[model samples]
Target chain A: AQKVTQAQTEISVVEKEDVTLDCVYETRDTTYYLFWYKQPPSGELVFLIRRNSFDEQNEISGRYSWNFQKSTSSFNFTITASQVVDSAVYFCALTPPIYNQGGKLIFGQGTELSVKP
Target chain B: EPEVTQTPSHQVTQMGQEVILRCVPISNHLYFYWYRQILGQKVEFLVSFYNNEISEKSEIFDDQFSVERPDGSNFTLKIRSTKLEDSAMYFCASSVTGIYNEQFFGPGTRLTVL
Candidate 1:
């Protein structure tokens, strides 16, 4: 079984500040995919990034970056110079390599981020 | 940009009534899924379908839940009976292949059971 945990239930940050959301996963499989999704107030899931187990390199997309560390079983997402629009509930999900057989994602409880001006 | 779409943004129904949630996955995508999130809870997976059959499902996807790709473009989830506990935001998603692919999501259908 695969499980994902996001310990931070809620976070508040001022505009232009940086924030990092922590995610930890447990999976016995050697290969898997990690995902970060954002659900805004309108309740739509937005795909952020997907990182596979073999790719431990940190990724940066504009102001968004992700750190994948296999040793700690953690995939952390960071937002630099965040704006108010970034306020939303962020979720971390895990999918095993043999997805067709057991592809259902194990999702974290999600972290609600509130960005104040 | 291509996206998965779901219909009937909100549906209200009485207990024991049957309801079907609809989705149109992105063209060329091969795998589809249904998930639910109760108020103030983590999203829960219900079922995944591919090649016109269920590939995987969770315990919550019991006998009452069924998924069908009735035509080439539409994927539907039917609930045999509605329960108060069944009220939640039902999301439909699709992926190009399998585990390695990103699952694109629809805006979701908010089902309200009365």
Candidate 2:
């Protein structure tokens, strides 16, 4: 069974504030992939990042950063100096490799972020 | 930056009607997938296609759901006799390869079953 949990249902912060969205996953496969997506009012999912299981490197891309910790099975995403345009529902997803599954992605419930200007 | 494209951005159908959602994946991509999300819910995988066949499918993809790559450039999901429960936003995604390549998503088609 592969599952992703985003404990934060919703988060509210003023513009320029930093926000961290927590994500924890459970999977039996040794090899897998994790991802983060942003869905705005338009209802389209915008891919943010993808991290493989073997690489636990913390990555930063401008205002977005991701921390992948294998020991804790947690992949957290943080937005620095968030703007009102950042308001959206963020989703964490998991996908196993071909060796394990058909590479179908399973998603978390999502965290609705409200960045008020 | 290459991106996937979906057609019929919105569709409305009565219950028991058949509907086909189409997608044009990234030209170089080899893997294709379909996923849907009910309003206020998580995105759920329906099926995956590769090599002109289905690679895997979830429980949600029953006999009522089918996928096809009718042409070299188009991938489509056909829902036979759609139910009211089938109303949702369907998304199409594609990846370059199985391992390291990341999947890119399209805008999605909003299916409204009445």
Best by TM-score: 1
Task: Give the runs in model 2 whose Cα sits over 4 Å from its true position.
Answer: A98-101
Off by over 4 Å in 1: A99-102
Question: Per-residue lDDT for A42-106 in model 1, tens only?
Answer: 99999999998899999999999999999999999999999999999999999976634546777
lDDT for A98 in candidate 1 is 62
lDDT of 2 by residue, B6-88 (tens): 99999999999999999999999999999999989999999988899899899999999999999999999999999999999
By summed lDDT, the worst window of 10 consecutive residues in model 2 chain B runs over B95-104
Measured against the true structure, the TM-scores of the candidates, in listed sequence, are 0.98, 0.97
Task: Give the per-residue lDDT of model 2 (tens digit) for A1-117.
Answer: 899999999999999999999999999888899999999988888989989898999999999999999999999999999999999999999987548435788999999999999
> Best-fitting candidate, measured by lDDT?
1
Backbone clashes per model, in order?
A: 0, 0
Pairs of residues clashing in candidate 2:
none
